[model samples]
Target: MGIKKQLGPIEIIVNNASVFDKLGLEEVSAQELDRHFAINVKAPFLLAKSMNEQLTTGSAGKIINLNDWRKARPTRLAYGVTKSALTGLTRTLALSLAPNIQVNEIAFGAYCHPQIYPWVDHVRISA
Candidate 1:
């Protein structure tokens, strides 16, 4: 009845869900950072871990970790920091899942996702 039942197993996972609220270093709270990391880093890590476990012998799986170019930027401090951390996580995951499950990252400088990233779509560029 569910997607897993119909599709057999999760072969490809796109860790795409994340929040990017613009916040300065002084504006970001502990809870805000925790929330951002939980969604951006922890969720993707957990999904990859679960995928590694679900994979059968000789079968390959794919994990695409979606990130933004703002990871190094000063704005959106918490989101930036979390995404930076996720890059490290992705690298380690790729090493751990070698030959079977491949983990990769997709960094977007400009993109649109009305539901998840409404701001990106409406952001104005003066340059």
Candidate 2:
């Protein structure tokens, strides 16, 4: 018996929990990669599975996954890999949970202090 079952129905779920550790390809260990997948990918899948019944019963259920847009950054090797997998998960879930639950993803760009990333101005200008 989970909170969703106890409370009856759930209309929306936001999968925002993620682990962003800056580690290069060579620096990332197997355990770190597993951890990244567990938190960034598996957790959302489990949550959505658990809430499937309640979500289907709702008038309009929604599931939003917080993702990242930067894909080729070498510093975020494992993180990027997991996020890419999550993107696929979002697409798959959108198809599988259709008619009842709407699955979507919000991909974010680089988020750092303006002073730390002066190049952000170029992105802003280009956009």
Candidate 3:
């Protein structure tokens, strides 16, 4: 694939990069939605597929994807939907690249608020 040829010997592939869209389904513009998918899902998929090409039989490699724990909430529907798809991609790729490559996803939830994060700290998770 293009990735393998472009960047050979990718020992570890970290699907850590992501983009968030705040708009609800009805308010989300086509361009914004496409950008979300491009960075969140498509990039990771291409990288994993490319890394699989470089991996040989009996060789070991890892692909880890960072996902959101708040994906079930309707407020984050667009972002959550894409992350859900990413989770599916992780599982499917794990099966396809099994016996040589290990693929996994991690879901995170917390209350750390960064300055750039637009989400208000009004919502609280009670467990």
Candidate 4:
């Protein structure tokens, strides 16, 4: 869809949309897993493929993948695997698009638990 845009070209793509469900794997259905992969993995891959031509013309285009500690957790099997694939895609793209585009991934740690607790006296997490 974006490739057909008259914006000339796209220099940067950030794959950041994700769904984080705090449920056990058994409780999560196949459809839910598919939805996660559709957004987190497939969307980015398709976007990158569609923009390959535009990206090749740029000197230093960038594709940044947003990852998180959840990717390493075993509990969220589907989310973790999809995110892991995204990280791998990031690395592969970095090498594949070299000399023209740059691919990078930034992994973030979970901070909401200890920070969002309203009953704990943990140093005014909100402040």
Full-model lDDT for every candidate? 0.86, 0.85, 0.81, 0.76
Count clashing pairs, candidate 2: 0
| Runs with alpha carbons beyond 4 Å of true place in candidate 1 | 1-3, 111-127
lDDT of 4 by residue, 1-127 (tens): 5644757577788888987765467867989889878988899888777667755443567788898855754557778878888888888888887867778899997565754475345644465
Higher-TM-score candidate of 1 and 4? 1
Q: Report the lDDT of model 1 for residue 122.
A: 56
Extract clashing residue pairs from model 3.
Answer: none
Q: Which should have the higher lDDT, number 1 or number 3?
A: 1
Candidate 2 error regions (>4 Å): 55-59, 115-127
Q: All candidates: CA RMSD in angstroms?
A: 5.5, 3.5, 5.2, 3.7
Q: Which runs of model 3 end up more than 4 angstroms from their true locations?
A: 1-8, 112-127
* Top TM-score prediction, candidate number: 2
List model 1 lDDT by residue over 54-86, tens digit each.
778989999999988757657788888899999
In angstroms, how far off is 101's CA in candidate 4?
A: 1.3
In candidate 3, where is summed lDDT lowest over 10 consecutive residues? 112-121
Weakest 10 consecutive residues of candidate 1 by summed lDDT = 112-121
lDDT for model 3 comes to 0.81
Ranking by lDDT: 1, 2, 3, 4
